[model samples]
Structure formats: structure tokens, C-alpha cells
Target chain A: MRKTLTTIIALALVAGGVAACGNSDSGGDGKIVLGFSQVGAESGWRTANTKSIQDSAKEAGITLKFSDAQQKQENQIKAIRTFIQQKVDVIAFSPVVESGWDTVLKEAKAKKIPVILTDRAIDSKDTSLYKTFLGSDFVEEGRRSAQWLVKATEGSTDPVTIVELQGTTGSAPAIDRKEGFAEVIKADPKFQIIASQTGDFTRAKGKEVMQAFLKAHKDIDVLYAHNDDMALGAIQAIEEAGLKPGTDIKIISVDGVKDAFVAMTEGKINVVVECNPLLGPQLMDIVKKVVDGQETPQRIVTEEGVFTADQAAAALPNRKY
Target chain B: MITWTRHRLFWPVMLLVLLLLSNLFFTPDFFSIQMKQGHLYGSLIDILHFGAPLILVSLGMTLVIATGGIDLSVGAVVSISGALACWTISQQSDQGSLGVVVMAVALSLGVTALLGAWNGLLVAGAGIQPIIATLILMVAGRGVAQLITDGQIITVNSSPYKVIGGGYLATLPFSILLVAIVVAATALLTRRTALGLLLESVGGNAEASRLVGIRSRGLIAMTYIVAGLCAGVAGLMISSNVSSADGNNAGLWIELDAILAVVIGGTSLLGGRFSLTGTVIGALIIQTLSTTIYTIGVPPETTLVVKAIVVMIVCLAQSPSFRAKVFRRPGFAPPAARPGEPGPDAAPAGPADPTETKAEVPA
Candidate 1:
């Protein structure tokens, strides 16, 4: 009899664990509960982004429902459905990729829950789907890296042979950054892209690709990597090839990671363009503005800065991410 | 056709050397190496070092393909094993301890072996198609890795773990040593024993072998387990090299490369007649080509096309029909219609049957 009773209790606990818990909020407590479907803790930047949002939500006394999609669009859609069911006042998500969110966005709209796009944008043509987009312009980030390269090699009449290590192919940043960089460098006939390849935005690939570039090109003057990790990897490659990275190959990259800053201080990297991943406080502010019926712009751009060796030295200690 | 070219390693070795020589035109110092802080540091060294993972994966793949079975889950297993090792190491109070890292390696290998056993059960016991059985894990293993990592790129800074991939022993990459050990062990296990012949027999004709005395099921299961063990070690190498477990990208599309390496090594997909040396050379050939691409200034966007074209040429050169058609003399004949035959069409001969004339397609 006792064994049967114990078995029944165990069965009940397992059953309870499987079911989704419903929110008990009726909005009478004067707190706006926000449901956020994140694009998972993909990188250090993403982890910091999540932290900022959660911390900001707590500061504003808003009940935040957080869900990590682990970089899957399907998971994001499921999380959105759960948010709609919970009747949260606001929903925000950083999409894993553009497109394929029309159905879920329409359902959220039907439920009268405003959706926000943070960090990344969606491809839905219907402008009414998202309340606003708040993120860095990746194209502009690319242009900044190119602009720095052009200035650093301004007076030289000699051709600047460049090798580009792109991020994941077909990603928004990879495509837009290539475009923006190409647009800025096209006018200058001396800045020739000798080689360009996708490193898949990982350290090992970056290292491997950079090793190849070093072997292929004896006169490569500029190395433009898509992200800090790739640049860091190239630094190792360049060093192993017995060439000074900052001197022999002027390294320019995006994403102001802490390691990038260290690399700059070590004379391995020349320039780093920032694409700020920390958007929590601003995200929370917009949520409040939306709640108070204040006018919020259709798009908001984060304030970001470019870092050189001197700038990296000053900012490395204070940089949150 | 000459007997020399018929040897499996002939074309692959020639292609590798040709590719390496091509490097000299772009980078004059392609073959130069220098000692740096008691370690070998050069592009050639880097090829052997970075190529270690591919070498290991394709080594296991060669055996699997020899059994007439494919394991699509090797890439996924690589991710899972790396994730497990990194996760376990990170949880320890001392990440750099020899005992902890050893335990982590054991734990990761153990789990992946079980996964291999699971695949073996499906293919050998349940009689499921090997491709489909491995494909199930191929799709689901990444999710399992993501769960273990909590959807984060788990980075561990253990010095002992660092030694596995990045450290040097006797002025050579520690990774190269690991590769050598694994390759040597695999060669010895097969060549020095009866296992190699047994595998060939089973793969060459499973039903016939079963009718005889061979336990084909046990042998098939053993191959999958070995493949899992190989992928597990590769995972450790990759994660240790980067000091991180990236669930999504850890071993992405590596299975395709391994299969390619196995095919390039002169292993027929129809099974039987495996070559460990040929597979090693094939893996090196691939590594050299990739390294040469960067050194030769191939455009990044078209790199894949360039590689595909070169691989095609090498494969085409090895094709017997192509050789017979192109290399045939003006008076060439098909071995004089076999001396015992009364006429050209007296009876069905080797590969002369139209139905048996299927081109060997490597998957």
C-alpha cells in the first residue's frame, strides 16, 4: 500500500513538470509584464545582451518572461505562442534570421500584444507587425571599418592589397557589411580586394583561412575581418608567419570584444568598429514609453564608437561587454 | 591500363605532391619551417596540425565505409563529445587538473561510444539502413549538444586541456602526435590482426559471409563504435584547439569531408579492400588543397567551386574508363577477349555485363 502511494506521488511530480505554468497576472498590480524571446546565448555578446535586458527589467519593476530559443526559429515561434497565451503586455525578440515570422506576428497582433525587434531585424513587409526596431546598422559598421582603413593608408600611392575574412555567408551582417565596405572602397582604385572568403565567424575557421591567405599573398597590406574573434585568430596566424600584424598587415575588424581590445593594446589589431550588443536599458525605456503612450520612433540606433589602440586602452576597463 | 596507376594511392599521392608544388609559384617559402619557442611553427606544420581533426574523422570513416555503411552522425557526435568534455571540465573546481581532464575525456568517449552502440544496434540488430540509422543521430545530436552547453559557447581555459590541441612535444604539435598515435594504432589493429580481412569479407559479401561462419552483425556494430570513438577524440581536439564548445558550428559538415576523404583514399563504397594508408594520404591531399587555395589566391566566394573542380579532375583521372579511352594506344584491345573464351561474347565476363557497368559513385 505504501509503495503504491509513493509511486502515485512520483507520477504526479513528473506530470506537473511537463505542463507549462500559466501566469496569474490580471494587470491589476500596476506592473507591465514583458515576455521576451531571446535568440539564445550564442556568444559573449549575446550573453551580455541578455544580462542587460534582465537587469534593466528588474530596475524598472517590470515582470520579464525570458525564453532562449537556442538559435532556432522554431523555438522562437513556440516561445511567442506561449507569450501570447500568457497575455503579456509586450513581446520582444532578436530573430535568428530574417523572414518566416509573419504567422506568429499576426497572431500576436490579434491578441493585441505589441512586438519589438531588438539586435536583429525581420523581413516581414507589413510594417505594423513590429512596434520598432532598435539595433546597430551593420552596413554602417562595415563602412566604418573601411573608412578607418582608407584613412590609415591615405597618402600611399601603392596598391593596398586586402584580404577579407567574412562572417557566416549569407548572414545579414556578412552581406550588408561586404556591400557597405565595397561601396566605400570602390572609388579608390588602389584598394584592391585580392582575396575574400567566409570564415563562418568562428576562431578555428578564421585561423585556418587566415593561414591560407598568408601563404597565398606575399604583399597583403590590409586584413579586414568581419568580427573580433576572426581578427584575434588572424593575429595568431600572422604572428606565426613571422610578420607583425599591426605593422605588416593593418588589421581592421568589427565587434569591440574585450579580447579585441587586448589585441589592440598588444599591437596585433589596428582598429575595431563597435556593434553594441548591450541594448537592455534602451529596450526597457522604449517599453515604458510605449506603456505611457509616448511617441516612439519607428527605428532607434544605438550610440557606438570605433576603437584604436589608444581608445581601446581607455575603454577596455569600462566596456561592459 | 598500367598496374602502377591501378594502385589506390598512386593518383592521390601524385595529386597531393602536385598541389604542394603549386604552392611554390605563389609563396616561394612554402616549404620553409622555423622553430619558435621550442615548437614547430609554419604553414606546413599548421596543415598537419589543423588537418589532424579531418585525418582522425576520415580514418574512422574509412573503416565505416569499408563495412559498406555510412555514419552521418560523426559530425554530430563530434559536437556532442566536445560539448560533454567541455561541460564536465568546466564544472570541476580545478579545470587544469590532469585527473579531471582525463576523467572528462573518459566520460565524453564513454557517452559517444554508447551513442555509437545505439547506432550499431539499429543497423546490425534491428536491420535498419545504416544511412538512416546514423541520420537520426545526425539531426538530433546537435540539439543534445546545445542542451549540454545550455545554448552557450562554453569556453574552458584549462592548461592541461590546452596541451591536447595547442601544446608542443619535441618541437612538433601535440596534435600531430595524437594523430600519429591514432593512425598507427588503427593500422596496427587492422594489419597486424585478422580484423581487416574479416571486415573486408563481411562488407564484400555479407550474406555469403553469414552463411559461412562470420558474425557480420557483431563486426558492423564494432565499426560504428570505432567511428564513435574517433569522433569523440576529434571533438576533444577541436574544442581544445579553440578552448570552446560551439554546439552549432563545432563539426558542421565534417561528415561530408570525411566521406570525401574515404572515397579519395581509394575505398570503394561497395565495401571490401580497405586502405588505411590511402585514406591518410587522401586526407592530407584534401588538407594541402585547402591550404594551397589560400596560398594560391583563389577568390573566397569561388573557393568551393575551385576545390570541386580539382577534386573532380583527380577522381576522373582515376576512372578506368577514362584511362582506357584516353590512354589507349591505336591498336589497344580488351585483354584479347580472355584466353579461355571461345569468342568475344562466349560468356559473361568481369564487368562486361551492361547491368554491372554502373559507375562507382561516392556518396
Candidate 2:
């Protein structure tokens, strides 16, 4: 039938297009074809992270086939399937929110295209599904934030009434950071979280929710934002209320973005726990290691640190994390 | 009593009052206001600044709603335009060049317009539902934005952009002025032209409008194009404000807020009628409620629940069916009715005849 012939031709074209992407020099002292699926630009840090990978790929002589999933898991799955069809040598992606990736990872494993998670980690029971996760330890980042608070309010008579501006609910960072911070904060009876809610990791919602927190709570001694954006938003609300932000109420946040350091230098924010986003060098190192048939760990933990106002100011000119 | 209560705005107003009263009881200095730098500074101004984008997008949404079409892609359009503007500016020889800023704005608008037309073509020419058609772009546009930025925040040291996003014009924000212009222009466009009439006709009855030679499809597509333009403008403002082209986070979840604003303004999501003034007021109310909650020190965890309740109340109040039912109950009087004496009986004023009014038309 004409319809069947047309269908066959259409199928052939698709197959040919995919096949064409695979004719690069083989991995024997030549370029390695890498299919990099990125969680679409949703934040400043994500944008920076993506650029790192792309630039690194160019420098490392890898033929990169990039796909942006636009912050959806389904799209990521489809992109991965396409990558498999293309038969790229290695697969790298930043999973958006960190679940529903097991089957896709298994498929990548079956294809022998090693998977590397950038920025966020997955919750898969099968550890072998991914070769390694190249990102900051989210738990440690949270603990650093709580530890700063514990030290700051050690001898204060006023029971430290803290409010938390959480990141996206059910996200890897949100889940792990909450667990890690609570692990430390639960030990002290005086320190209480009067209000803790998701700002959805957005500036607008952070400001909105912080406004409500300010209205309802009479005495919030400290604000612990899951990310710098929320903390910055809370700062706006704090200043609007004719109250000093870092001085009147001690503020601590995670994600040592350049803006966070700027806030710290201005004395608007108290401290920031760094979650390094510039993973270009590490990602390149891992990609080369994988392609060279060299053994690498299943998790490559990036070092994280906490910085106060003085440290933030001192390090502002040179801090890349 | 029953006849008098059949108004939509009654419920939303009541809900607003209830929210305010609750805040008064719970919050300290919930109504506090201060003067700073020759302008009002408080939770109120903060709400306005934050809510301006929602209001602008909602105004755009009002027209699309009037045509029985929804724009799920506005958020993505915003991201793309924001990224485009930032990337374009970053490519300048001089970082803060005005030529680059103007070119960036123009390029961003052109691209967004093209994308908007793509949606319009699918919905109008291909006869796809607006929701499904726009949803495709919603999923892909952000990816395109990321591609434009090479998945990195394209930082620009542009003065014009800083002014647009973070710079103040005398005492007010430049972003606020931009929003005002968009709102004013849209209001005049709809109110001062026959375009509004045509849109309502198409939304109210597409077949009837077609029979009357209105070219309904063209009108529908035009509304989308305009909405896209508005979103592009919003994108420029957002990126300029942040001084970075972060496509990922530039305008995430903005579409939802715009939808909420449209709904709160009593615009029927099913389409046919819209109110630009009401949309602005609605955005203000939502922003104020949010500010009040934060100022009053509501637990941040409870804020979502509170917002949900507020949305529900506003929606219920605006529903004619809900209003009619509430008014028919005892002890209920119409908002406009006198307090002491019942102005009218709970029955039809005259012998009722079944007549086909525009209000009775099924969507």
C-alpha cells in the first residue's frame, strides 16, 4: 500500500537522521560522542552549571549532543531514549527534582553509556544505574547553615524563634537539607522553627511567604532560607518593615551565589553555606575518566563551606563557588 | 432579598474583608505604613512591586480569555525573551551600550512574536484547543531559552537594563512604570476600539461570528500575538531587574499567578467577558493578602493553605450560581439592599418569559 510505503520512508528518514549523528571519530585516541541532557535553565546556578558542561565539552574534544528538558522528567526520559537511539558513548544529565529516572538510567546502563548526575542526585535503589553524581553534598550544606545558627545564638536569653524558607517541596536539596538541618536543630530545645514552608525556590514567593511570616510571628530571631534568593527576598521584606535584616534578625542561607556574597558585604545577610555550581572542571574530569576506561567512584562529592559576613567580603573578589 | 443577591463581586469583597480581619487579630503593625525617599514604603509598596508582573500578564490573559483561548506559554515566552535580551546585551562591544539594549529589546520582541504566532496558527488554523497548543511551547520554550544562554546565566553590565529592573526613576521603580504603560495601552486598545466587540462575539459564539463575517480566527490569533508581545515585554523587565539572563528562573510559575489574577478579577476562564480594571484590582488584592499574611507573622507553612482558601473564596464569590444560592437563604440580603427594610420580594419582579439573553448562552 502507498500508506505503508510512506510510513517506511518516514521511518527510514528518522533512522538515518539519528545514524548521521553517530559518525564522529571513535573513542580510540579520538573524540567521544557525549549525549548531555540538561535540566532546562530554571535558575542562575543552573544556567552557570550548563555553560560549564558545554564549554568543558568543547575543550575536552567531545562531540556533545545536548538536550534541555525544560524542568520536566518525562522530556528528560524521551531525550535519554533519543540519546540511546543515537548510541552516544556517554550520557550526562541534571535530573529535575531527582525521581522517575531509574528506568532511564537502567536503559543507559544496558546501552553501556555511563550516566553522570550534575548538580542534583537521584533516589534510585540501584546504585549502579548511575556511574557517579558530580555535585555538592546537600546534607552538609544544610548542616553548615544550622551549625552557623547554633554558634551565633549560644548564650542568648531569647529563645531563638527561627523561620525557614524551604526550596521546592520534594526536591533533592529540600528533602536532604531539611533532614540534615533538623538533625542538628532537634538536639537543642530552645531553638524552634516557628514557621517553615516552601518558597518554591523563587524570589517572588519567597518575599510573599516571608511577608506572611513577618506578619504572624511577633519575634522571629533568625530566618534560615534554603537558598539565597529566598533569603534575599526576606531581606527586602525585613527592610520594608523598618527593621535591619542581618543586624535586627540574624539571617543565614545556602547557595553562596555572587549576589549572596554581595548581600553579606552590605550587612543585609549574615551567612551563606556554599553549594558550588561551577562543576565544569569536575564534570570534564569525570567524562574523560569514563571514556578512558578508567575506574571512578559512584559519587564525586564537591567540597562545600560556610562563610560569614567578614569571610564573604574577604572572599567576594575571588570566590567562584 | 434573593433577587438582589445575584451579583459576582460580593463574595470576593467579603473574602477580602475576612482575610483583613484575621490579619488584624494576628499580626502586629499589620497596617503600618512609612514614608521613605519621597514615596510610600511598607508591605503595600512591596506587594505592588512584586505583583506588577502578574497584573501585566493578567491583563494580556484577559483578552485571550475574552476570545475563549488560554495562554499557557506566556511563562515560557517570558523566559525566552528574557534570555534573548540578556544574551543580546552581553554580546555588545561596550557592556552598557544603549544600541545593544535597544537591539536586544527589538530582537526579543520579534522572536516572542514569532513564537506567539506559532501558537495562534495551531489553535486557529489547525483547530487545536488553546490549552493543548500552548502547552507544547510551554514545555519547549524554556529549553530554547536555555539553549540561547548556553545553559548559563548571561550576565550583563548594562546600565539601561539595570535601570529597567533595579534602577529607580526618581522614587518609583522603572519596572512599575513599564507595567503601567502596558496596562494603560491595553485598556485603551480594548475600550476605545471595536476589537473588544469582535473578540467577545467570537468567544460568545464562534459560528455566529463567522456567519456575520467577523473573521473570528484572525481576531483570535491577533489576541495571542498581542499576549505574546506583552509577555516579551515582561521578560525584558524581569531580566533587566535581575541584571542577569537566567532563563531557568526568570519567569517560572508566572503563568499560574497570571491565571489566578484573571480569575480573581472575575474574568470567566471559559471566556466571553473580561475587565482590565478588575484584573488590576484583583492582582492588588492577592498581593495585599499575601503581604498582610507575612506582615502579621503567619507561619510560612500555613501560607499555601491560606492562599488556597483565599483563591477558593474569591472564585466562589465571583460565581453567579454561588451568589444566587447565598442570596436565596434567610438572613441574606443583597449587598446594595437597605439594612432595615426588604426592598424587594424573593421572587421575579414580573411575569417571567423565557428569553434568550447573551448571559444565558452556554459556553
Q: Fill in the DockQ of model 2.
A: 0.36
- Best by the DockQ measure: 1
Full-model lDDT for every candidate: 0.83, 0.77
Clashes of 2: 19
Mind giving the per-residue lDDT tens digits that candidate 1 earns over A219-304?
88999998887787777678767789999999998888777887898888999999898899999999988877787898999989
Per-residue lDDT of candidate 2, residues B181-209 (tens digit): 88877766766776766787888888799
What are the models' TM-scores?
A: 0.79, 0.78
Residue A181 error, candidate 1, Å? 3.8
Model 1's TM-score against the true structure: 0.79
Give per-residue CA lDDT, model 2, range A1-321, as digits (tens): 476568769999998887775543334455787888887765556656767777888887787888888777888899999888777888888877767888878888887888888788998788988888888888888888888888888887568888888888667888788878888988788889887877877665676677667656769889988888778767866765557999988898888878789889999899898888778778888888998889999888887778899887788997653
Candidate 1 Cα misplacement greater than 4 A, ranges: A1-42, A50-116, A121-131, A150-161, A182-192, A244-248, A265-267, A284-296, A311-314, B14-43, B88-103, B125-128, B204-211, B307-363
Question: DockQ of candidates 1 onward, in order?
Answer: 0.38, 0.36
Checking candidate 1 for backbone clashes, the offending pairs are: A216-B295
